[model samples]
Target chain A: MAYSDKVLDHYNNPRNVGNLDKKDPNVGTGLVGAPECGDVMKLQIKVNPETGVIEDAKFKTFGCGSAIASSSLATEMLKGKTVDEALQIKNTLIVNELSLPPVKIHCSVLAEDAIKAAITDYKAKSATPATAQTA
Target chain B: MDNHHNCWHCGTPDAGSIFCRYCNSLQAPVPNYFEFFGMPLKLSVDLARLQKQFYSLSGLLHPDRYTRRSEQEKRYSLEASSILNDAYRVLRDPIQRAEYVLKEAGFDIGEQRSKDVPPELLEEVFELNMALDELRMGDDEVLPQLDESRKKFLDILVEMDAGLEQQFQKHDAQEGDEARRAVLAEIRLTLNRRRYIKNLVNEVDKLLTARNA
Candidate 1:
């Protein structure tokens, strides 16, 4: 099925494509995959913990247009939002924003999952010491 | 999903005929991956067998055999090639294959609470998580200490994998329904832990990459 204009637009020209300083406590990296499709998405956020505001957002996704668009739009929406606000970003919103087709709906869902995963990763990282060597 | 018939070129012998039995030209198979593998619809599977079958099929029906075929025949070959790749990818990985099989069985592991990662794995998972966290935040001093734990984890996975293989062989050998069902349940759990540990290793690899970066 062909993606809509919006989906194609965001997909062909994705935004916020990069990684955050995952090692930096303030950076949250969300890495998640849909085992069904083998689609992986990594969403990152730079948040101001004291204020809970997401300062910068980025993503790297390997999947369909819907998947890429969903993540791009999710990060776009995350700019300046608090952690709670960003967490509240739903799959439907991403789907609606990207105009994803029904069959590709999971792409949007994965984007949402990636966001949560990033937040979780961020929180986990921040909760620990400033520098711990993991191998 | 495939449909089989006699090989149009040479109808000598045919089962799930995807080629002319005599000519061996490209054709469509009657059986799908699930049927070809003789597997139930579940998220977990016997991967080694799946790999073996995949190679077996590739040896026979790969598009290269149809290099001299008509345009329509080549199109069929291209589609078949892609499907083979897709099926192999889906069935080879424990997680992808498991989810697909679950859907085929009309079940959702994510929707069900009973399958929420075996509780037995909880302690191990927690310890791994805690250690990963500490390692991620710990100083370079911790690097020297991680080797033992990494080796231990690998050894455990290897042991479990071998045990699972034995169970799988027994299940496959079973001639009756009851024996098969029991083995299936055992495989399901073993596969889950295998998936979990695989993820942990990936996470460790990521942390290592991040450190190097």
Candidate 2:
């Protein structure tokens, strides 16, 4: 199937494809997989404790081009957004931005799930008194 | 089994049998694979019996025999023969057979998300992918690690197959629909995990072959 230009562009030049220190109290890590296609994606965000904004985002995805592009675009979208604003991110946004086909729409869903998972992880960590005091 | 109909040729009432009792004409084929093979709806199928039935049906439904028959019989023969091939192909493989049963039981085989998978399995899959990426980038030092990973995955596949066999037997022996449904759910999860590891093994094999060549 022919990939949309946006998908191809992000795939060829994936944005923020790397890793963050999972041990850092400020870092929230999300590891997710699509069992249908055996695709695994790890998305991480570093939140600024004072401002409640995402200071940095990174991801590593192992799957098809669409999957890679979806996560790549997800990280780019995560940066600079407040925790609540990031929570508003939806799979449809990824689907629309990537022009994903019906079959590949799940890739966008996976990315969206990753974003939520990371935010949830970050929230859980920061909620703990020990981590909150350290931050 | 509720497929009773009148034979087109002889007007004989048939109870969904492959052939009409009165005129011995080939009737409309049964859509269900288990019924088509005259076997119980069970996951642990008898391969020997299935093969015997397959060979017999292959000749019985051969289109050549319908050349001189009526248009309806010919069409029935073609349809039955096609279904016969598909049933055999699916039932012969244990994995495909389980998937067929799961699908028939109203379980969605594909379209699963990461939440359904265990975290540990995902971690293993991720590390394997990382090793594969290194190997692809010409890191020959990772070859031994890759080989070990391949063996570990293969061993896991073997263990999973054995586990699936146990589940198959459990499914077949269950008395109630609820009990069988429980087994089916477990089978689906196992199949998903198997699929992931199977893909990893294939990737490792492909990369190793390329490096050797």
Candidate 3:
């Protein structure tokens, strides 16, 4: 299938593709996969403990153009937002931004799931006393 | 659909027999895979016997034998033969058989758009995919990394295969629907993991072949 220009661009030059220091107390990592397509995605967020704002975001996705584009846009939308605000990033918005076809909608959903997993990891780490509390 | 049978050709009724007694013609309409093979719906099948039955049935239903028969009988022969081939293909493999039974029992084991990646393998799979992407993009420098990931994924596949055998036996040994469903779920998860690993293997092979070319 022909990918839209937006999808091709994001896929070709995916934004913020890398790994975060998962062991760092301020960083949260989310790893997800779609068994059907045999695709895997990893999304990570670094949170500022003092302000509860996201400092940076990164993603690595192994799938089709749509999955890569979805996570690329996910990280781009994540930076600078508060943890709670980042959670509001919708899969539909990702779909719109990436111009993913209906068949690729699950890729967007996987992206959403990855971000939520990252936020959950952040919250779990924050609850631990070792991590600096993000009030 | 059970406890009653009628010969499509001669209208002679038979009680649950696959072939009509009066006309001695195959009469079941679209039999389930197990029923088509005249085997019990169980996981542990005797392959030699299955193969023997398959070949024998194929001989009887060969299109060559139907050329001189009535058109309606010929159609029935073709349909039965087609279903027979499909049934044997699915039943001969343990994994395929497990999946077929699950699907026949109304469970959607997996699909082309499935997104249920096992949680524990996410990190490893992510790294593997990165290597795959790099390889695909012509970064030959990452060949060592790709090779290492392939070995690791292959080990996982081996482990999953052993686990599948245990699950398959468990499925066949279980009696109750609840117990069987639990085993089937485990089988589905194992199959999904194997599918991912297989795709990884295919990707690695592609890169290796490209380099050689």
Candidate 4:
């Protein structure tokens, strides 16, 4: 199937394609996979603790073009958004933006899941004062 | 066994068998693969018996044999022959058979998300992909690491197949619906993980072949 031009564009020049420090307490890493297609996506967000805003986002995806584009676009959407605002990010918005076909909708869903997972990890880390105190 | 229907040719009440007993006319074939094969709804299939049945049924349902027969019989033969091929192909392979059972049991096999996969497995998959990416980028140093990962994944596949065998037996041994559904759930999860690792192995194999070539 032909990919939408937007998908192709993002795939060719994936935005924020890198990794954040997983050991950093402020960085939230979301590692997820779509087993049906054997796609793995890692999305991370570094939050500003005081303002609770996501300051930086990065993603590295290993899969088809649509999957890579989905996660790449997801990281772009994650930056500058607060933790709660990031939680409100929907897969449908990505689908519309990417013009993803029905079969590739799951790729967008994977991106959305990655965002939620990252936020959850960040919240979990921040909730534990022991790690913050030690650091 | 509950698929009792009247024979189209003889109007005889048939017990869902392939052919009518009284007038010996071909009935509409059972759609369910297990029922069509006259096998119980179980995962542990007997290959020898299944093969014998396949050959016998293939002969019986050949369209050539129904040419001189009624048009209805000929059509039934054609339909039965098609379903027979599909049934045999799917039931012969253990993995396909398990997948068929899962689909029949109302499980959504195709729509799995990342949450379904265990976190540790995803981490391994991610690292393997990173190594693969390095190899793709002209980094020959990671080739040895790729080889090691490939071997590790292959070993995991072998171990997983053994585990699947046990799950199959467990599923077959369960008589209650609740117990059977529980086993089916486990089988589904195992199949998903197996599919992921299988893809990883295939990817590594392809890259290795390309490098060698």
> Model 3, A21-125: lDDT tens per residue?
998889999888888887788899999999999999999887889999999999999999999999999999998887788999999998999999999999898
Give the DockQ (C-alpha) for candidate 2: 0.67
Write the residue-wise lDDT of candidate 3 on B167-213 in tens digits.
87888899998999888877777787788788878878987887799
Which of 2 and 3 is the better model by DockQ?
2
Give lDDT tens digits, candidate 1, residues B1-213. 333455555565553445564565666543355754545544446678788888887766567877787876777777776777778888887556645544454444443111334434443444454466567786665565455556666887898778876865676677776666666666666665666666666766788788889
Regions of candidate 1 where Cα sits further than 4 Å from its true position: A129-135, B1-164, B167-213
| lDDT for predicted candidate 1 compared with the true structure | 0.69
- Predicted complex 4: CAPRI docking category: medium
> What would the DockQ be for model 3?
0.61
> Better model by TM-score, 1 or 3?
3
TM-score of each: 0.48, 0.91, 0.89, 0.90
Per-candidate total of colliding backbone pairs? 20, 0, 1, 0
Model 1 — TM-score against the truth?
0.48
In candidate 3 chain B, where is summed lDDT lowest over 10 consecutive residues?
B110-119
Over the stretch B1-213, how does candidate 2's per-residue lDDT look in tens digits?
645889877888763569988788888898899989988899999999999999999999999999999899999999999999999999989999999999989999985767877887787888888988987887878878878888998999999999999999999999999999999999999998889889889888887888789
Q: Which 10 consecutive residues of model 4 chain B have the lowest summed lDDT?
A: B7-16
Which regions of candidate 4 are displaced past 4 Å? A129-135
Over A1-135, each residue of candidate 1 has an lDDT whose tens digit, in order, gives: 878898888888899987777777899887665544445577899999799899999987756678888888888999999988888988998777777778788888888877887788788877777756353
lDDT tens readout by residue for model 2, A20-119: 9998889999989987788999999999999999999999999999999999999999999999999999999999999999999999999999999999
Which order, best to worst by TM-score? 2, 4, 3, 1
Between prediction 2 and prediction 3, which has the larger lDDT? Answer: 2
